[model samples]
Target chain A: MSNYSLRHLQELEAESIFVIREVFAQFENPAILFSGGKDSIVLTHLAKKAFWPAKIPFPLVHIDTGHNFPETIDFRDKLVENLGARLVVGLVQDSIDQGKVAEETGLNASRNALQTTTLLDTIEANKFDAAMGGARRDEEKARAKERFFSHRDDFGQWDPKNQRPELWNIFNGKKNMGEHFRVFPISNWTEMDVWQYILAENIPLPSLYFAHEREVIERNGTLLAVSDYLNMRGDEVKMTKTVRYRTCGDMPITGAVESNASTLEDIIVEIAATRMTERGTRADDKRSETAMEDRKKQGYF
Target chain B: MTQSGYLDMELLRFTTAGSVDDGKSTLIGRLLYDSKSIFEDQLEAVKGSSQKKGLAHIDLSLLTDGLKDEREQGITIDVAYRYFATPRRKFIIADTPGHIQYTRNMVTGASTANLALILIDARKGVIEQTYRHSYIASLLQIPHIIVCVNKMDLVDYDQERFNEIVKTYEAFASKLDVQDIRFIPISALEGDNVVNRSTKTSWYEGSTLLHTLENIHIGSDYNHLDARFPIQTVIRPHRQEYHDFRGYAGRIDGGVFRPGEEIIVLPSGFKSKIKEIMVGEEKVSEAFPPMSVTMTLDDDIDVSRGDMLAKPNNQPDSTQDLELMMCWLNNRGLNPSSKYILRHTSNEMRTMVKEVIYKLNINSLSKDESDKNIGMNDIFRAKLRTTKAVLKDAYRKNRNTGSLILVDEATNETVAAGMIV
Candidate 1:
């Protein structure tokens, strides 16, 4: 009569590790979609744990929007180099230069939407049958219905209505020649779970997650970080404030919130007491109600 | 606000099956809203969408109806996962649609659920949907079943009506193989007995829905008697510092494993002693069910992916012939004679259906032996022969090691989900 049971975080970690291993076993070529965000950082950590004593079997694929925080790029390169893992960069600017996708115009313009083209192109060029992402269902509405082994059509489109029924721990990643899968090992994790796991494991993350004094402008009730990518309008005045990002995205569109939560413990506490969703401050999601869903349908991670 | 104890909270995953009319979405919405799991921004978004659609009240269903087609059609087309947490436990709700045609979806959701939540309308007591869902829950071997008699307000919060419905369900459920069953009467829309106790239901002396969910005994849900670990992959660093490091990586499906325990690798029948168990960076004294860890054996035995490790005295059946109850998931009908990919645990092999013995009628709970044509959403018992032998247990014992899915080779789509008998 063994009475052994795993706690929620441990169980979630085990499940994710299991999924990560399954991806390696089932697919000939797979990669972790590294965005330098906390979620992706945790994912890369899990992948490393999944195949301990061994280098992560797959490369880390990052879709660089060219509008990222300099700290994020540095963190990405350092982590990849330390782990001795290959890093694949899918540049949205390259896609624009190649005339595959045009850059958006006017204020609030970002390379966020154009990453889909570059991402798909990278997947095709590399022939990656499975691309593991750090997307969690609790992060957005569209993600709530996502499968652990989410199937994609040859055209890189997601048909939500006709998804194959996934059951138990058995995920069917079998696909045709041109088709691929978008696998999310952390689909069951919530934002709080991710933070708690990070704190428990002492996983290193980009410095953007902690409070820092940075130049920012308040636009439409959101604190936009003043960076080289942003074309600051005359009305938007820049000022210095202590703020931290709840989510990491393009520097021009990703908004930060004023906070003193510098440590992981403080961030977890701040989130616990927060009434707003993490993506509420993200200007990209604020563009429309189904912004995430629309972007996901177009093959954006 | 402290982070120390939050990681120790247990996880409870439950599935809810009910049609749109039964207020399934509303019940889930209420659970999220009243528990403070629903963020203000999410609530505001739902409110804006509700107002756009000319709704007098905030339609909570809009919170879960995610897809454009589902929103336009006003129904849940697939299983949508929802997460919430209390101080005591974290919950994952696999919200499955309840229309009869979507029986496959319900089965998919119930497959991994620790508990099955079947909502019954107080106005229409013990309907076909209730029986169908209960039967499906029983068939899937979900350990616990909580029958929520919803809309008690419409029935004037009558205790007698709730009791009558419970009696009908109990009598019907007695025919099924359900282990633990509980009843809760509540009005999802009125927020009575869902999260908070209601004055209207003062006659009822039971825990609220939230209380029942938080306090369910789920410690003994897993099979800890038999030790089973199916290796998903082999971890080999090959670095000069840690040369000759060969660790088998997989999640423990059943029982408890400790360092120095004697175990045998399956299929090849190689005996080895457990040297160490590593869960991430730390070394653990013991590993149990659902814990993924890398284990190194004392002897340099040859072990690869799709292999199983178990106590020599207690071993699973290794055979090519299997008897299984399968739910057809795809739109295409079953081709019994054609070869299909049968994936069990981490092992995959080609399999062919030898015979379709019978089809189980979910609503009637009867077997139709004559009809062998299995179509979408059909549950049937069949004989399968795999090209390679598989290590498996009965589905009633261990779900992780006892289930397999059949995929069509041509299209590479999962066509059926099977449970070993």
Candidate 2:
């Protein structure tokens, strides 16, 4: 056990820190795409350590769907205040109010897809050359081929086939004036690794992640929290299930799981034995097989 | 978590090179399925797709065929990284494409790999690709190579066919620089000797592919004798408690560093003592390769990003002239007069291609000294003249310090990956 090699979690952490610092050094302006999810929470914590004692240099850009769970908003505000980092909010509600995007009117209607417009507009408005995200490759098939430093056109579109070949530790962040980059520091991390690192580092997370009694509607075999943003339809009876969200996304799109994993240790054990990928719980992905790949091309985080 | 031995699990990154027809993706899918890494929902999606496409059996390759175009064409055009873990180790498989874009994709995948899986059809004893792939693996200095003589089911699990292919590969690979080479007979499509011991190959005594991957000694893959830290950025908090804290933040490229160790900064050639290695505010007594840490120096010298700190006695070479074996990635051919931005570790300097020594005919495993026109997928040896001296080691000696990439000034795309000779 007296070896110098690092465990998988440690190695992943180091690689992520290196990438964060590279974003700071390579781009004129870079902001973290924080979604108040477990993945983004871990990413922000790593940024804090990446430049110890120095507050995170870049601001956190949240593409608020305006349909978020109150817990996620509250958690986001508190974390930002604690880190003394700046928070930039891009409201999809604003996009709707300005007649920029139309809301879908259907049973599976969600503001999840509208976040792309807000996100792209936010990046352009802020003139951010790079947006560091918490996206992991193992989450979906399209992401499995994503580069750590992914390129984006001026329109903030992802060209999977036309990406620059990333080699070794060197990241190429160079682009035209109008073009930008979407950097995924945690591209190599898996769902299990994220939970493991969170436990090992004692990183604080949103309480919504812990099992709690909540009013939810079981639709399509997945639990959706009953929030003001989501109204139950006929025969979509509300069930007071002790559930925790596997992913922190928009209220209508995110799905919850039946669990009693209130403690971090319990959560890790639950995740280890689980037979589902984290993104599998996401309702938006069920719309189509290429749902994620399509949104990613249109600049969805 | 600790009771499950999760804490002790190490990481291993490997590359797989073979076309779809050779069952490369099928092998990866088998590994994931047997390891329980493939989730139920994902399997269901694959099953649904298989049914819609009228596939007789579940097409496992669909799982790795990611992008829309790739899925439509039933081919992989880029290197898709796949993850699977057993209890013993976490595996990151760089499933490199084996199509027309072979060399560039394989080089990118092999750069950080500890082992490479070169597939050979049992029926096709030794093909041109076997030589090309094995050469690239050796050129990149990958530590281990597993020649998976696949489709044993097609060959009736004949040990003689597998043995013949193994001997042919060994004779060709002997001319290369790789150290550890092994052979395995398996049928990735039929789930034989991939994750489980195959009774079909009763004459084979070697371990299964998964077993070898789990048990391979990868601790020595990193260079531990030389401590080289290239400063990525300067972490100057300027806070009240640590007003004068000037920590050099970087990942150790090689070896280890501890407090009270004497070191020297490159280019400036300034001497300093290791004050402490800080992970955050807390101090770590020792730091090693791939671990990013902030270190302070006892002596207050001018140190910034792109600066290297190494033991004075064991320093790397620094010179304006460099020799490198580079793989051209961009579509535009190499122009000798054009200057490219060469990035080595944390250092970036403008450099010009002084001369092209030779272009490698990978399929033939020969050097084409007369082919100076380096095009895409071409690996060529060349001399570079840097604007400033760079601290470097041979790629074979240390991958971290020895490797670099060239960025086109106009396109800004990474055009070439260079391995110092």
Candidate 3:
């Protein structure tokens, strides 16, 4: 008998750590895809705990689109240095320069989709049979059906219909040569779980997460951070507003919510009260109902 | 409160097993639906799919057929996971298929389940699929078995039919190793004795499915006698501020771990004393099964992946030869001479099947001794010889140390699941 009760966050952390250990034991060559977001950061922390007394055996892979928040870059570098783990950055810009992928050109163009080419190339080059990601099932519709050990074909396409059955704690990370598995140890975790885990762990994150005074413009009910990447219409007036990002992605696309939740506990409370999902704040997902699914099929993590 | 009440909320993972039309999906859908965990959009989508299929009402089976092919074929092909939470506890539901060819899926789903929800249509009493599911649940050592008599409304809510099915199931279940057996008459379509007790069934005394699920005793599911923590990785934050920090991170596979306890790491045969148990700092004094934490030891020892830690006095057997019941999943038959990767808990190693003792006839629950080769969805008892010694116990004794999965190297598919004897 004990005096303490396991909170919701503790349960989720335990489950995620259990899954991470399973991945480490099952896969030959596995890597954690670190995007420096809160979810990925929480994943890294869990991975660290999954293998205590020994360093994380797998390297951290960052699919760098070259267009990233400077704060995210700083967070990534600091975390990698402190953990004493290897970092492998698959540069989308390099892939474009190398002619492996063609860059998209448009008014609202971004390198989000092009990251898939570099990611697939990196997996092939490094022979990463299993790539652990921070993808949560509650984030989107298509992701809800994703298995823990998501199989990818030779072309790096996700065939949702042919996914293998994953039951219990047994994750099948088996793939033929030229094929790979996208492992989501946090498949059962939701956004609230991630935030609560972060709060409990006291894990550090980029400044973009907390409320800060920044120049922003309201566009289609979304607060877009005023950056050089954005094409400001004359009617869309920019004003300095205290806002915090719900999800950190490309600076040109990710939206900021009108928030004053500077602390982890505050963030958790705010998220609990919010009605819309986290992806609702991102402009990229707003492009189409199946935007995330379409990008995921092309091997974008 | 009693001492047991301290651990009131125990995790209950269960599998729903039944043939194609036994209302397995409907039962699961009803469970999730009544729990209020089904999102509105998901419900709407399922309703849309049902309407498109020309059904007069929402087909609850549409919830479990997640895959496109399964939806198109109007049958469950693979095991789908569903989660729901009630005030008492959270539930992880493994919705497994019931086709004879999908026997492996049932075994996989039931492998870690604490309960087995074996649905039997009141009209079809104790069929082969029911026997197969119940037998496999017993083989897997699922702590609880609830033989749900589904579609009771179809049989005009007949208590006689329910009683006959229970008697037939009990007679057969007596031959198998089952701890707790329960029966409930449910109308998944009409929602009787599922979420709310049915008014029509005044003769029934047992609680509803949801009520039983929320109150089932799952505290004894874990083997508290054995302490097993397979080391997944080592954490040494090399910064100057935390230069002396050294913690072993892994989930507690079995038993309880506390600070100041003496422990020995397996394979390396190194002894160490636990200095602190940290769950992301605020050092914990104790930890138990399924809790993930970092522990700093008194001395630095050589502990790496595939190695397990336990109390020095009570150690698991380190043996190469293990007898187990294996269920093959892939289309390709087992390569008798080929080496495969066998994963147990966090330990993985190359192993080979020494002999196929006997394949269980899933339909008839009979043993076929003449068969030497095991193919897809074949459940067989066999002896396995691993390249390295594994610390193991009977599946019934300790699920953490007793269960394993065999991976096919050539195809890179999880070919089979095995239970240590």
> Taking the true A–B contacts (Cα pairs closer than 8 Å), what share appears in each candidate?
0.78, 0.71, 0.27
Query: What is each predicted model's overall lDDT from 0 to 1?
Result: 0.92, 0.90, 0.80
* lDDT of model 1, residue B40: 92
Chain A TM-score for candidate 2 is 0.98
The C-alpha TM-scores of every prediction are 0.98, 0.98, 0.84
Q: What clash count goes with each model?
A: 0, 0, 10
- CAPRI quality band, candidate 1: medium
The residue pairs that clash in candidate 2, if any, are none
lDDT per residue as tens, model 1, B1-421: 1212346689999999999999999999999999999899999989998899999999877777777778878888889999999999999999999988999999999999999999999999999899999988988999999999999999999999999999999999999888999999999999999999999999999999999999999999998989999999888888997798889999999888999999999999999899999986678888888989999999998999889999999999999999999999989999977899999998889999999999998888899999999999999999999999999999999998999999999888889999999
Rate residue B308 of model 2 by lDDT. Answer: 98
lDDT (tens digit, per residue) of candidate 2 on B229-304: 9999998777899899888998999988999999999979999999998876667888998888999999889998
Error of 1 at A140 (Å): 1.2
* For model 3 chain B, the run of ten residues with the poorest summed lDDT: B1-10
Docking class of 2: medium
DockQ of each model against the real complex? 0.67, 0.64, 0.27
**Residue A115 CA error for candidate 3 (Å)?**
2.7
Candidate 2 lDDT tens digits, A54-121? 88999999999888888999999999999999999999999999999999887788999999999999
